[model samples]
Target: MEGLVKKLNRRNFIRVSAIAGGGFVLGFNFLSSCSPEQRPGQLIDLNAFVKIDTNGEITIMNPNPEVGQGVKTALPILVAEELDVDWKDIRVEQAGLDTNKYTRQVAGGSGSVRESWESFRKVGATARQMLINAAAMGWAVSADTCHTENGMVVHKKSGKKAKYGELVERAATLDVPQEVNLKSNAAFKLIGKRIANVDNQAIVTGQFKYGIDTKREGMLYATIIRPPAFGQLLESLDDTAARKSPGVKQVLKFENKIAVLGQSTWEVLQGAKMVKAEWKDDGILESTTDYSKNLKSVLLNEPKEESRRKDGNVLEAFSSAAKVVELDFEAPFLAHNTMEPMNFFAHVKKDSAELYGPIQTPERTRTRIAELLGIPEEKIAIMMTRMGGGFGRRLMSDFVEEAATVSKLAGNIPVNVIWSRESDMSGGFYRPMYSYKYKAAVDNDNKLIAWHHHSVGVGSSAASGDSFPAGAVANFQVDTEEYKSPVSTAPWRAPTHNFIGFSEQSFIDEIAHKIGKDPVAFRLEMLEQAKNNPIGKVNYNPDRFATVIKKAAEVAEWGKKKAGNVFQGFAAHFSFETYVAEVAELEKQADGKLKLKKIYCVADCGTVVNLSGAETQLEGGIIDGIGHAMYAELTLTKGKPDQTNFNTYRMIRMREVPEVEVHFIQNNEKPTGLGEPGLPPAGPALANAVFAASGVRLKTQPFIKSGLFA
Candidate 1:
């Protein structure tokens, strides 16, 4: 961490770039240190990080990624409230993922909103004060009498005002202001308003371009074919017939794979079909399920260590308990079926390279591609676009590396490598299949006295990057073993929140049933202990947690019974300092299956920014989470993924989507994460509702396939 400012504000304003021929046209930047030439009575482009364009437009840039959670809308609302800008004119853009701009670019762990509140407001206030200073200088009057409104400078005595647009170039010349006053939440206008997403217009229309849409001229499209089984290598490839395919240009054979490069996407596919290729697994191909079995034994019996916390003794309490309850939960691997498949377009011309695509981690992708290509990081230019849907799939850099390799093989020409829908599904970068084993014991009054929870899976950081180690419970232990897989894994929505919601919440339910206590009351009791009890350094805001639970219960009418087929199941979880509670309604249909009716979601993820965006995330999360619960799994046969595409891998569809109603508590606090916080609770909530209706406790995932309904 350097004390000194690295450089003056530069107008290298990052914005959406329309692909031009084979490369993007670079722009001129503005970075000046002189007093701005701003009009005497206009909004100032203060030395602060936030700035307003003269056209009454507002732009706020910071470190957070907008992976469909509406960071662009939520974050700017925090600054626009203080900067005195019209909501219509505000334009939120991605800040350079620089340490100078944002301390942490890693978009997981739910730290987005909690980490940036003070820093973002400072940026806005600094700009506002500069406008005031510039106004007083022009009016030859004391700055105290001047007031700012709608990006204009107002002088009461003289009845004089100036538009901010008139101050653009002048504000660009001013020194960065050192001090500025920020508005309190009491004076805010947009903080609690139900604004829609700022980027929605570009998204809904066909004009919204994703990384997969990035195009380059004189560029080739490529597709790679690898060994069908995991740990297999390319024995050999004969491309004699492939080179003759229409539009086919070249066929390349890497160590273990073959790539077909051509002038069009169609040509690449055509050539790939003619290439003769087979894999030699080197004798490492084994059943993915078999490896998972080995991993389970490793976690359960392999000398587990206590990586987290313990507030009380468990051995004595469990021994004396009048009752004990136990259950094991299992979840299979999940795929992030983003609408637009993974795609990246890269062009390397001798020394410098250009890349355009949908990138969640632009800086990381740049570094990785540069390293692989033996180029300086600065020599690479990266541009990003709105995603069809990311769900943590775009966080990895391998797709970018593949594009770079294809571009190099195709010579200096820019190449766009678009992964076909089949390619995206078959190529393995997925949410790891997971499982959890739990044990709990209760005292004479049915109060929970002792508990032990252990989770087993691949690539799950039950306690990796976050401040809270998995051991957040008393007399508790968590063990995770990364089950070996040929497929790589990245963070899926809510990450371990998926498994935690199941194991922790379900155990709570089982305990309630064993003790003859109401589920909600039982949860409240546990939360009372959770409030006073410390669970390591990781944050768990007790008050907010209670708020969502109470709010959800009140709205869902927990005590009321909807007779007939509809049954209600309630669940609540806290992650990323945000709390979400959901009540799922289920109906046992004539076909002997669970049918979802309606889901009520109440969330307190701190403050709400984009009402539509927040609700959309809630609605989408429930559907996706429920989809996994009802019908989605990746079964393995001899170390190979058996499910190939959407035909076999079903998702919750139009008929399956339940009527969803989401209510956000109006709070003055700054925003927390909205994207993933809503996903974890949906699963347990849905499962709970199903149990209420069927009298069956479904512990295994893809519950339908587990024979609960069958």
Candidate 2:
């Protein structure tokens, strides 16, 4: 049946397509845990696609969009390692969106490398084997007697060597090996090495083309005027002045928005400023004070929905506990604030549409555009551009949709929609504000017996029942409630783990201090219990989690008394299938001000690909985590953001950044996620260190508001 074939094809499949220039093209599916069955008319998955040309040039297509996460460099190294090709001879290219040719092409979730690790290795190994077979046949020798090194196949006994280019013609004719041998861990030459990012030179040289840099022939620049507040809807629009502005071509109104099209970005922006628009409140004009009060009330009351996770009787354990430690934490909504403002280029014709932009979800955006234009899905094409910064902002395609709508409404001419800094800031889809109430029950012996968590947020809950402290406690329960709001919300960085890690780990530290136990030892004891006698389903590897915690503590010299008002704080978390632990060291100045001196991070994301890239990711995540936790906050006043630009919105300065040292646990396991795991623990560690130094328990986010640093 067609359904059966589709289900089986989702597991794994490989296809070799003909090359236009008479060479080889190998496409390997990402999910290879099971054997792939041949199915008619079914397009299977391919995450790693490679091409070998006649001139000995090898090209690897990076399926995932590059949003400065270093997949542009780290992913190709996976293929190059197993393909046995010289790194200098390989070319890396950004792949276009093609559902048939690639799967999981979108960039989000920190899953690009994690999903492609095994399949990409198989891709390179399969191609290498095909070339070996061709060489062995040409030499009249057994395939087992041939080996590949540096893009050449050699007949071991005869010492006959042939470059990959020389054998590509014959290799293309050979049947693909059903099972290919992957190189051992020791065989890797390019994976673990420190390799610079593929686009580093281009970025530093100002040659990189981001989405905002997109330009096309005869393309008109446009700016849109949207409602100033969340609950407001456009009631009236007067664009007569905008139409008469210099270089202004047309001013069109579509769906509560006024678009001013002109020859230049400046002209369009100036024209947009001339447009008059009136808005009316469509619903409740929610403010930060209202959100905070409502969320806190939800946390205090019983959730309307069923409990997310319930284990042994938490009520009974709490009733019989010797002491109950309870704490409530609050976090404000956060904007993505990508360096480059939102921009997209679109041209919708009668039957086809062309889109180019920095989008994390390209295929989804393309499909949406097709539906919006009433065109067939096959007629829409999208080209993904390197983003200045995504941080989960590009996952939404509002800007892309606006571009297509503007183009279609403007005589189907090419149009590029650009948003100013204020427009980008006011545009919704921010990280939802969250409030968490954590309770831990301890017995007379100071043993943690029960854990209960209640979370309330604007849109959805950011708590994972399977994360740490779940299986560690004998009785555990998690309850969550979502509050309806007019403001849009989307994932920011680690998403659920960002706030959960901070609140949960900080509570754990509080409990440890209450029981008079060292933080690191207390966590180790909990992990040991989870490993040996877990209460329920343990989704994380307890040993791996404990390893990073211990490593971080050791590296930071945890619990050792430091001279001159210095204190260290430790926190560990498991997120995105990666284990990360961070230690923050803070010192109090003579003036009684706290200074973040340094941060030590230990991560176990399995085999490191591109050591330089991994370190950069870890360090960047740490800095971002510390910066947001310390100074970033977004508030709403009458449903409009109080801070529209950097002038009012605060960010951590470079001078305030502490020295960060990253230590990666070396191992041979399959690589996991690295982009987000390093972030979750950074905030909690720094907050705990601040508490240790100032003897003040800060429960809210944007630590600057606490005035501890001052």
Compute each candidate's TM-score over C-alphas. 0.88, 0.96
Q: What is the lDDT of residue 233 in candidate 2?
A: 93
Residue 145's lDDT in candidate 2: 89
Off by over 4 Å in 1: 1-66, 91-114, 299-302, 305-313, 459-474, 533-538, 590-592, 706-710
Candidate 1 lDDT by residue in tens digits, 628-662 = 87788877676577877888887777877788889
Whole-structure CA lDDT of model 2: 0.87
TM-score of 2: 0.96
Give the per-residue lDDT of model 2 (tens digit) for 144-211: 98999999999878889999998998998877676777777776889899998888888899988887
Clashing pairs in 1: 34-173, 36-170, 36-173, 36-174, 37-170, 38-170, 54-165, 211-357, 211-358, 234-256
**Reference-based lDDT, residue 612, model 2:** 95
Q: Model 2: residues >4 Å from true position, as ranges?
A: 1-20, 30-46
**Top candidate, metric lDDT:** 2
Clashes of 1: 10
Weakest ten-residue segment in model 2 by summed lDDT: 1-10
